[model samples]
Target: MSGGVDSAVAAARAAEAGHDVTGVHLALSANPQSFRTGARGCCTVEDSRDARRAADVIGIPFYVWDLADRFRQDVVEDFVAEYAAGRTPNPCLRCNEKIKFAALLDKALALGFDAVCTGHYARILTRADGSRELHRSADMAKDQSYVLGVLDERQLAHAMFPLGDTDTTKADIRAEAERRGLAVAAKPDSHDICFIADGDTQGFLAKRLGQAEGAIVDETGARVGTHTGAYGFTIGQRKGLRIGTPAPDGKPRYVLDISPVDNTVTVGPAQALDVTELTAIRPRWCGAEPAGPATYTAQTRAHGDDVPVTAELRDGELRVTFTAPVRGIAPGQAVVLYDGTRVVGSATIAGTDRTGRPVTV
Candidate 1:
């Protein structure tokens, strides 16, 4: 359990279903106090206590596993390195893939548990042919299928999402918790990245990578402004450029790219952000075969619009071709594919053709 209303209620629901349930809380950080502060975040000692209380109320055993070493190596290090490489990384997806599903699931199976359950707003469906598939939750606004799409067949087979079928809003969850007299009934949702307490990505990177002043240049490579660090900027960013000069067309300029080699942040017109095709690397298949080329919907970011796309396997990598142009398709982000509600697969975005090169479209 995550020590939140959703997970707490999920545990209660699972126990109500008459299954042998055990609550497992992951201690990902070295300092437990950092995870329990005010109304935000998890993985703290207090949150663990809350999770244990919820499990006790539901008449189940609860345990806290120390996964700090693995979490740092898998999620935290990957996040830091991705930013250093000038790509925007989704640490949550990495956590789901490496820590939760891979490590924790393995441990759960070893402990003789039938399946590991969580409060993630996604569903796992067993088809008529006995094949498992991942689907979006009933609540569209709380759908987290994009991040959970990274799970492979093995992980999906041993996973259970208790809150998937229930279309409960945040308010409904809080009300349910209160009705049940759960300890976390009034506990606030954990927002922002859990590991990073301060919510300052730029400041964190600067401390890790040291202060590296660089030039913020336009498309023509002319230095228009200066920034304290290149890791602070991301592609398609319009704010924080701190450029004193106005655009020639009297319009706002947007970040088109970040060249780590040159240590330059490239600014250009908004048109430069549009892309029709993107190359996704490190493809992961969830309960499906690697069928050659197939049509599916691809979502680049969480809460972003899903675009009609054609996915093809080329030289072992999945390349997605969007029917229309998409903006803000950043590298290191997960591009999740879905056939209606079932998640086909997902991959890390490697690059894009922002220049609008015409192909066989």
Candidate 2:
């Protein structure tokens, strides 16, 4: 249940609906102290305990399964390596795809559970033909279908999200948890990345990849400044650059691109961030192939506004052309496609012109 109010409420709702529900918390860390820094939730002994307490309150059994090794290999290592290759990776999406849906779903099926349920803010709808489709949650502000869109048809068939139908805000969830006397009722939402414990991505990379200095160049290939490491910066970054020189027009500069091969960070005006097209690789279709030459809305990041775009499947890739140029379309981020309220599918953004070229690890 992740020891969160949303999952706690979801479990209670499932149990109230007469489903035989058992709460399973994936213990994804070997060291207790390293995983529990009070900055982020999940993967700690205390979180498991809180989940068990919630399960007890709901009258269901709970178990903590050790998935530390798999989590490290699948999510942690991949996150570090993606950054090393000069790409901004979304580890949360990887956790949902590899750990939650793939690993946990298999374990749940082996334990003879009818279906797995999570507090994810997304919906699963069954078609008349007995197929499954993913949809946006009723709570638009909390809709997480962007990350959960990576699930295939099989995974969707055996998944349930009780919060999909409820228009409960975060305040409502906290109130419900408090009303039920749950311990995590008033716990502040976890902000930092879960495994890092400390929210210093650059520090983590520096510790892992030693001290490698590189040049920070402008868009015209002029060396503007020097960075300790190319992995420390990301697209759209503006602060912590330590650049002493001010623009001729006295305006601020933003990160335009990062070139790992040349070991350079490119800086330019904000307009340089505009990108009209993006290509996504390893696309996952939600249900059926979308109708030919479909027009839909897409989001490149969680909580990002959905922009109008035209999507077409070409040679195993989805090429998207945005109606209006968007900014900061980074590689290794997910591009989720939506047709109104229905989630069509999602794919990893491989590269964009504004971001230079794709770096594969």
Candidate 3:
């Protein structure tokens, strides 16, 4: 259990369903419980206590599993490496892919458990043919299927999301938690990156990446400003350029690219961020691949609009074309495709058609 209202209620619901349920709180750090300072974050010492209390209320055995070494090696390091390479990563997705489903679920099966259940807001649909498919939650606003696009058939088969049904809203979950006497029922939701305790992503990167000064150039390659590090900037960022002078066209400029190898940041007009096509690498299908250049709704970022798109799979890569224009398409971000509510597939954005083409200022 995650020690939040959602997971606490998930355990209650599962236990009510008459299955043999046991609560396992993941200790994702090496430090002991005394070291954590009641931070408003997941996996803190306080959260473990909450999970244990919730498990007690639910009448289930609880245990804290120490997976600190594995998490640091997998999720934390991958987040740092992706930023160092001038690419943004969804560390939550990494945690779900590597630590939760792959590691935790695998160990659960080894210990004779049928499935691993959580509070993620995504549904699992099982076809009559006995194949399991991941689908968007009935609550579209709370849907998290995009982040879970990394799961494959094996992982999906052993996964269960107890809070995915349409009738079960966040309010209902909290109400259930309160009815069951869980202390986290009314607790505030945890936001921001958990590992980023201070919530300063740029400052954290600066400490690790260590100030590689880079020239901030416009589309014409003329030096317009300077940045402490190329990795600090991301595609489509309009703020924090700190340019001393106004643009010649009196229009707003946006980040077009970041070249970590050359240590340079390129800025251009907002129109430059627009694109109609994308090339995605490392495509992962939940099950078998579809037949043709099929049409599906595509999402580029979390909480972003889902646009109509037609995509074709070629040798494990995807050539995706949006029916309308998309802005700020960044490499290393996942592009998830959906056929109605069901997840069609997902891939890491590799490049764009205009990757090397400059946006003329």
Candidate 4:
């Protein structure tokens, strides 16, 4: 249930629909006290208690599954490694792909469960041939299909989203929770990266990857400033450069690239962030893979705008050419392609083509 209102109501609805539902709260953190509490945090000790209470009110079985080691090996470690390699990763996607759907679903099936149901704002549509496809939730504002883009066809077959088809808003879900006597009806939703208790990402990275002094240079390869570590910066970042010398044109500079090999942070004008084409690997399709090159809307980041793009999967790489220049696209972030509201697939960005030159990260 994640100790949230959405999951509580989802459990209630699934059980009320005559399906035997069990609420499973993942104890992701080995030491819950190290995790944050209140609205900004999830999977904390308090969240587990809240989930149990909600299960009690809904008259269902509740269990807290300890997946801390798996989570650390998969999501947390992957996140740190990606950052250390100067790439930005989506930890939520990894958790959904490896921990929840893979580990949890496998365990549930061993215990004779049909599927793993959650409060995710996405839908699973079955074709006439019994093939399943993942689609966006009816509530586009609350849509989370981007994060779930990592799920393949096998995972979709055994996934359930009780609140996907509903057109109601998040507020309505909370109201439904109140009507059902769920204690988390008015609970605040968790935000940001849950594991980082203080919400200071730079500080967290510093703890794992000890600071290594690096030079921050401009487009001309001229040193502009210095930083504690190259891992602390990301593409398109404008603030915290601490550059003593201002640009000759008096314009602000943005992070154009992070070269971990030389441990250098390159800063340049904002236009340098514009990218027309990018190469992505590790493609995960919701249904059948694309047959050929086709036009689709590409979303580069969560809550980011979708742009018209032509994508083709060939030779184990997905090459996406955007009609318009996409800004702030990093190598490790996922590029999810969509046909209208249906997710075609997602791939991890591996490199980008800018000004007819290929830059691999």
Candidate 5:
């Protein structure tokens, strides 16, 4: 339970089904001041209290589990490291794969719990052939299976999401919460980065990686500007570059890449950001690898528009070729594939292949 209406309702539903459910609200941080600054915080003491209150109203046992140490190491530190390495990382996916499904589920099993349940908007389906598959929520706009794509078959087997069956709107969920008299029925959704209390992701990283002044270069290797650090920018960033180098063609510039090793930022025309091919590592399949090379739809970021692509799994890596050029794909961000609404697989992008054909690798 994240001290939110969804989890509370999930717990209520589970209990209504005659299961001895325990509400476990993960205490993801050791900071005491972490509380509701609206509906956007989960690390606050107030959240735990709210979870406990909901557990009482639902007539179930509730406990706050401190996973702060692991969260810092896995999600927080890894985020800074990815940025320092000039790769955009999604901490939420990391938390789901490592902290929630791996750590929390393992703990739940050890305690004799049959399965771990959450309020995530995703679904697990048992195909007619007895294979379990992860599918998108009925509401595509609010679907979150994209982030949960990191889980493999084993993890999916032990997980449960009660909100995936119907295309229930957020307002409907809130109304259900209100009918149940949940205190958090009206809680606002959490916004911004959770760990960065001040909401400055760059400053939070800079405090850890510190500052290293570097030169900003154009695609021609010509120094155009300078920044305190290269990690502050991402691929395809067009604003706050604080650079004065105007293009000869009089077109606005966009960030093409960030080289953290040499501490340089590369700015170029927007077209230079287009990538026709992507080479990614750390491939994770919901089940086993595909029988062979397959054509599917893929998204570089969770909120990106899914486009048709040819994905090939070879030598333990995933190589994707887009039918049309895609922009802003960055190393270290997940490239999630889908066969319609069902999640195909996910891989952490390592590089791009601009000249590759949209064929099997």
Candidate 6:
């Protein structure tokens, strides 16, 4: 239940619908204090207690499964490695792909469970032929299909989202929780990287990767500032550049690229961040992979607007051409394709083609 209002309400609805529901809270951290505590985190000890209380109120079985090692190897370590390699990764997406739907589902199926139901704001539509298609939730403002874009066909078959088809808002969900006597009706929603307790990503990376001094350079290969580590910065970052040399035109500079190989951070004018095309790898489709090039809406960041793009699977990579230039796209993030409100697939961004300037350090 993740000790949240959404999951608690989802469990109640499933049980009330006459399904034998079991609430399972994943213990993703070996040490609870290492992760974010209280309402800001999901894997803390307090969250486990909250889940158990919710299960009690809902009259269902509750268990806390320890998956700390697997989470560390799959999501946590991968996040650090991606940052060290000069890439920005979405850890929530990785957790859904590797931990929730993969590890948890595998164990659940082996235990004779029919499905793993959650409170995610996404829908799965079953076709007449028994095929399933993942779609956005009816509540468009709270749609989470982007994070769940890694689910394949088999995963979709055994997945259940009790709240996806409802048009109610988050506040309505909280009200439902209160009506159902769920203790977490007013609990604050979790945000940011849960593992990082204080939300300082740069400090967290520095602790593990260590601080190695590097140069910050502009597009023309001129040194502008210095940084403790190249991994601390992300694409399109404007603040914290600490550039001593102001632009000759008195304009502000933005981070255009991060080169881990050269240990340099590249900054330039905002327009230099424009990207025309992108190449993405590790594509995972909700159903069968597309056979040819097709036009679809591409969403890069979570909660970001979707833009029209032509995507093709060539040489085992997703090649996407945007109708309008996209800025702040970085290597290692995901590009989720959508046809209307249905999620087509998602791929990890490997590289991008800029419009006017090079991304090299």
Q: Candidates 2 and 3: which is better by TM-score? A: 2
lDDT of 3 by residue, 158-218 (tens): 9888888756778877887888888889987766777776678898888887997789999
- Candidate 5 lDDT score at position 96: 94
Q: Encode model 1's per-residue lDDT on 1-361: one tens digit a residue.
A: 8788888998888889998888889999988676537657777677888898998888888889999999999998999899888899999899999999989989888988878888999988898987789999988889999999899988988988887888888788889988988979888788888877777878788888777778988878888898888888887899879997788898999988887776888798988788889888899989766678989998999889988999998997888888988987788888999899889889988888865642110
Which digits, one per residue and each the tens of the lDDT, describe model 4 over residues 200-258?
99999999999989999998999999999999998889998999999999999999899
Candidate lDDT scores, in order, read 0.85, 0.83, 0.84, 0.92, 0.85, 0.92
- Best candidate (score: lDDT): 6
What pairs collide in candidate 6?
none
Off by over 4 Å in 4: none
lDDT of 6 at 111: 99
Model 3: lowest-lDDT 10 consecutive positions: 352-361
Question: Which of candidates 5 and 6 is the stronger one according to lDDT?
Answer: 6
**RMSD of candidates 1 onward, in order:** 2.3, 1.9, 2.4, 1.0, 2.6, 1.2
| Candidates 2 and 6, the one with greater TM-score | 6
314: Cα error in model 3, Å: 2.0
* Model 6, span 116-191: residue lDDT tens: 9999999999999999999999999999999999999999999999899889899999999999989899999988
TM-scores for all candidates? 0.96, 0.95, 0.95, 0.98, 0.95, 0.98
Which ranges in model 1 have alpha carbons more than 4 Å from their true place?
A: 357-361
Q: The CA-based lDDT of model 4 is what?
A: 0.92
**How do the residues 1-361 of candidate 2 rate in per-residue lDDT, one tens digit apiece?**
8887778988988988999989888888888668745527576777777889999998898888888999999999999888888788898889988999899999889878868899888888888989988999989988989989888888888899998878888888888878877777887776567887677878888888777688987767877789888888888888999887787778789987777777788888887888888888999878877767889999999879999999998988888888888987778889999988889999988767544433232
TM-score between model 4 and native? 0.98
Question: In each prediction, how many residue pairs overlap at the backbone (N, C-alpha, C within less than 3 A)?
Answer: 0, 0, 0, 0, 2, 0
| Cα misplacement distance, residue 301 of candidate 5 (Å) | 0.6
